[model samples]
Target: MQITASTVSLTVDDVAASQRFFTTHLGYAEQAAAEGFASLARDDVAMDIVLLARGTEVLPADQRDQHACGLILAFTTTGIEHEEKRLRAEGVEITMPLREEPWGERLFQVTDPNGVIVQFVEWATPPAAENA
Candidate 1:
């Protein structure tokens, strides 16, 4: 099947807080919103987010009060260092400082107002591939 689009739904204590964070810092625009929910999207394909307020009735009973945890909403892009610096200059807290793995993956992470972990990564060509 062909997929049309994609989105990540996060349950948070404050939907508006997360909404503002995404729009202000992450280049996402508000696509739709309601009393306890918001849908945000970037112009790029497949970058959509939906935030639901904790305890909102729209969620399943077992998941209604759950907050986003144990996950990092990551974006892989170019100029990882510049993005990190730009975010820092904008007063965005850098939870994980930029670092590169031996395998050539450079990444860093930031936390949103509602404690959502967002990470950015850039993968370098492997040494073997570079020599090929």
Candidate 2:
């Protein structure tokens, strides 16, 4: 089967609170919902996160322990400066400020309400120029 898109599923403490934070601050549109779960998407690419109440059935047993997620979700953009400024103005805690990496990518990192780290990046060096 061909995979058109992918999503990172995250277990959250509060469904409504997480949904609101993503909708209000991160600008994600609600795509679907079930009894104790909701899905949000950006630019039509759906995320696999399912938020459940702290004491709900789907909630993990060890709620106090922090979940270790393997990959850091990154979103590419053409306007890194504009996004960084907007996020800072909204009181979003920026873990990593805008900076150019050794690989020549301008990027920043922000943590969501549920502690999910999201990265926004822009390529500074074009592949064509690098190859020349």
Candidate 3:
């Protein structure tokens, strides 16, 4: 199969809220928008996102009422610390403080208006092996 692009569609209670969050803070541009839907894209990233309001008829009848939950939308990035600091200066709340793991992963998280967890991560040097 030849896949040309990737997109993630999120069923949110407030499409505008999530739409604003992505465009204002995350550098995504609005590709399209409507009463209860929005299509977003970033020039630097391969992934695009679509936001749909809960109960919108565009969704399957069984899924229309369901809202996005228990999902972490993460981005692997460089200069994570700088990114974190920049976000803090922009008045964005940091839900998870920056921390580095033993296996060399540094990450932090922020919650969007509609409760989507957006996490940023960067890999660092591996932990040294302990002598037996």
Q: TM-scores of all models?
A: 0.94, 0.77, 0.92
lDDT of 3 by residue, 10-103 (tens): 9999999999999999999999999999999998864799999999998999999998888989998989999999999999999999999877
Per-residue lDDT tens digits for candidate 1, residues 35-128, read 9999999998646999999999989999987889999999988899899999999999999999999988999999999999999988877457
Which candidate achieves the best TM-score against the true structure?
1
For model 2, residues 35-102, the per-residue Cα lDDT tens digits are 65778777755454555544555556675343525557688777889999998998887999899999
State the weakest 10-residue window (summed lDDT) of model 3. Answer: 123-132
Full-model lDDT, candidate 2:
0.74
Q: State candidate 3's TM-score.
A: 0.92
Q: All candidates' lDDT scores?
A: 0.93, 0.74, 0.91
Clashing pairs in 1: none
Model 2, 42: alpha-carbon shift in Å?
Answer: 2.3
Off by over 4 Å in 2: 44-70
Better of 1 and 3 by TM-score: 1
lDDT-best of 1 and 2: 1
Per-residue lDDT value at 130 in model 2: 93
Report residue 7 deviation for candidate 3 (angstroms): 0.7
